[model samples]
Target chain A: MSDAAAGPLATVTLRVDAAEIDAFAETLGMPASPVPPTFPIRFLFHPEIRAALAMFLPADGSLPIHVGQRFRYHRPLTAGETLTCAVSATPPGGARPFALVRLDVSDGTGAAVCQAESEIAIAAPGFTWDKLK
Target chain B: MNPPRPGEKLAAVPIGPLDGAAIERYARASGDDNPVHLDPAAAGAIGLPDRIAHGMLVMGRLSRLALGWRSDAVLEAFECRFTRPVPAGAALTGDGRVAKVDALADGHRVILRLLARDADGAIAAMGEATLRLPG
Candidate 1:
């Protein structure tokens, strides 16, 4: 994947709801006092973000495999904060077809709070990088 | 508490013989309603034998382990690479070892090498984490 091909694929806004955080923590069997480090992943499921991701998914309804992830926390996230999450993807490369996805999250004031990177494999049977490109 | 020495193995934390119900709860809570994790039929359509667990769920479990390592420790970064899929009813265990420790002005910067393995002893995921432990 060339640097030029790596550009913002989608941007979505999410409000950090304490209730949702609680639910997420509860589901994972963790304490809810502090937001879980991986909670930002929920932003990927935002309707707009999902729409953007659909562009790379297979028409046959096969979901991409999440092969890797990385999270960097700038500071602790607080409840009641509005966050802007920007997602970008590199063109699929490597022996297996996989794309590197990056998510940049900032608070309403635009200060960076966290960043996440994920590697997703789209190499299910009959799927090819050409289809995504 | 004393700072962890390099190469010290952290205790293993058992996660699950995960079932569909747990996966569904995660989907509901995280808003990830991917059919591949929810519907076996959808998973089978794509060649998966059964519904699979969310990779993020495994990461969350590992994060919990890291956080609980020390009350004064704060997580700064976490990274993981999924090596294999965790099918429904498969259990997982997470463990880590202190890889490096550097004394900082306020505390220690600790690097941990982490792994999650399936019941069959196959590595399901492996990664590293960075945490700041107060002196």
Candidate 2:
């Protein structure tokens, strides 16, 4: 489990787009700004993480519900800035299948921007994570 | 909005009428297309009454409030507990206050307490953030 969790599950670079930022702001009923505070989570998404969660997904592939989330930002991320993130997933000890993902984001200049952690709790019972690992 | 005193209550800002459109837009922008957020049928299949909005969406409102405190400030730490599920289309509000204030060598560390409440006025999520502002 440790070995599987040690290596990064994915890496993706994204140029923050004004439109995407606008879309996010629209959801919160806020007018467009440089960037929304939670916008950094965009870089954390990847196929591998999706596939991992798919192992325990409900028939419709909805989710493991998001239980908690946290972030530490070095600076405010703004629109049009390019950033990359390396993501790692770790399942904490428990019978219930739940996991935490950490995304370490860096700007185009390679300076650290922020670290976002998301905790997801799965309601899947009787599924063996050993198969996925 | 009081003078940043500990335990001072800030005016509540109405957050979401978090509908399907908003949920889908957030999913697309954040790249988190967990079907439960987009597909009501899928959500019901899993026993949810309907597609649930993302927990981070609630917390994001708090983040916005914290950043609005000072344009020059940075969020040094932010942590939140998802107390309950916020359904899509719920009229939610963002509420928070100053929890503590400390003088650091480089800046003033203001601790903030945050809450997002669903329409029933029950707390859906709660947490605290520490923001560092210039001295």
Candidate 3:
């Protein structure tokens, strides 16, 4: 994809290994469910995924977030579950670039494990109030 | 007011200098194939020098800190807003405090206020979580 204004958007994918999932379940002290454990466990095993997304997306340097932006997650993973997470921007009202993301977890046999969606926004690095005005 | 839970305090948790393979591994796990995360050139187009981490991935880190305090507590709700970007190969630290703890007749629950930071001490993400603890 080119850096041009019209270049194709970027999307990142991350995988959750089974071994790591088990370790996470063990850490949380819950019997491994047919799904992957939520939150903290997702962090340790799939941190690289987080790093990759942050490299490009912009953020608020301080506190107080924008109204349209949010985050979300799904439940546990059964052994051998493959999750596909994606983040991108959409045209809100066909003008402003609105951040949107989704996660799709599934096993090879055509059954989905978990799915979620949330909004995102890319603030220009060193975002300035003047730019917004 | 009643006394706070045994070991409740706003604190920090440490994380890491993530490698490329790990990033790739997470991408596969989440089923996302965005080039910016997998391709350096794509990231550059977005004003990023190289591939970066996922926001949800950062939230996951924050979640770990929130849940780390108890052995059998189940997360009832996990929510946050990504405040900043966390670059690849950067060290991460997570923090949280007990916002509220309610003891019900059946069991007890706690609301944890959370924050995850990058090596630079930047608040990469912030949020709150509700966990259910049985007696």
Candidate 4:
């Protein structure tokens, strides 16, 4: 049962464009697609991916779902890059769930750039998930 | 007085009034309407109590605070731990203390360790940001 409780990791892959990355980069005052060696590629796309992966997790549809406790990603995401994101739960314990997610962003040549992990939690039941809409 | 050096303490910037519309706009702009960030109903159905703000939005605002320290500052590295949820329409604040200042061939740089707090002073998001300064 403990082994079963340690659910298998979930994996997802996404393709990102320069324009989309640029929009977020603009807020940071950087080019839409950062120049190679300018800034790490993980920073370029991890935020969005983090948010997306957070949503992918089920939380009973409640108002205050807090999933990420800690996140670590090292590498840069380039425009026209495709990232294969993987998430898995570490054995669940004591009122929270701990997991690690890795995002592999690669170019056409299959050269990898960014790898990231997020530590997330979903409060145990007893919250209202029906009123938020 | 000249603004505190990059590594020095800077003023705290408040967060919140987490407008749902703004979040929607960010979703539309980013093309990521993850139910948790966009649909309150979806968030609830999944057990989330309310609509939560996008983590990047909080980071963007905090980065603004860091840039305010120096005109030529360029973000070098930004990392954070999402500590708490920032419910929509609540007031939030940004706090930071400079971690280090570096001298580079192109310019001087400062690293600011920052955190966004709710009105109750609870951390909503915490992270570090590095910026390049004009020599």
TM-score, each model? 0.91, 0.83, 0.58, 0.60
Candidate 3 lDDT over A1-133, as tens digits, reads 1122321233334455566555544433334453333522253224554554344343433111121223233344545545454333232334544444444444455455444445544434343322221
Cα lDDT, model 4, residue A109: 61
On DockQ, the candidate that comes out on top is 1
Clashing pairs in 2: A62-B36, B18-B89
- lDDT tens per residue, model 1, B1-135: 886899998889987757888899899999888777888887777667888999888888878778888888888999988877789888899999999999999889999998989977888878798999887
Cα lDDT for residue A90, candidate 1: 81
In model 4, what lDDT does residue A9 have?
A: 41
lDDT of all the models against the reference?
A: 0.83, 0.73, 0.53, 0.56
lDDT of 2 by residue, A8-69 (tens): 76677777788877877776656667566677766656565555435433453334777777
Quote the lDDT for A18 in model 1.
Answer: 94
Residue A68, model 4: Cα distance from true site in angstroms: 3.3
For candidate 1, give the docking quality class from DockQ: medium
In model 1, the Cα lDDT at residue B32 comes to 85
Error of 3 at A17 (Å): 10
Which residues of candidate 4, in runs, are more than 4 Å off? A1-15, A22-66, A69-78, A81-97, A108-112, A127-133, B1-7, B11-16, B30-34, B41-49, B66-77, B101-110, B119-121, B130-135
Can you rank all candidates by DockQ, best first? 1, 2, 4, 3
Instruction: Note the B-chain TM-score for every model.
Output: 0.94, 0.89, 0.83, 0.84
Query: What is the lDDT ranking, best to worst?
Result: 1, 2, 4, 3
Which pairs of residues collide in model 1? none
Reference A-B contact fraction recovered by candidate 2: 0.64
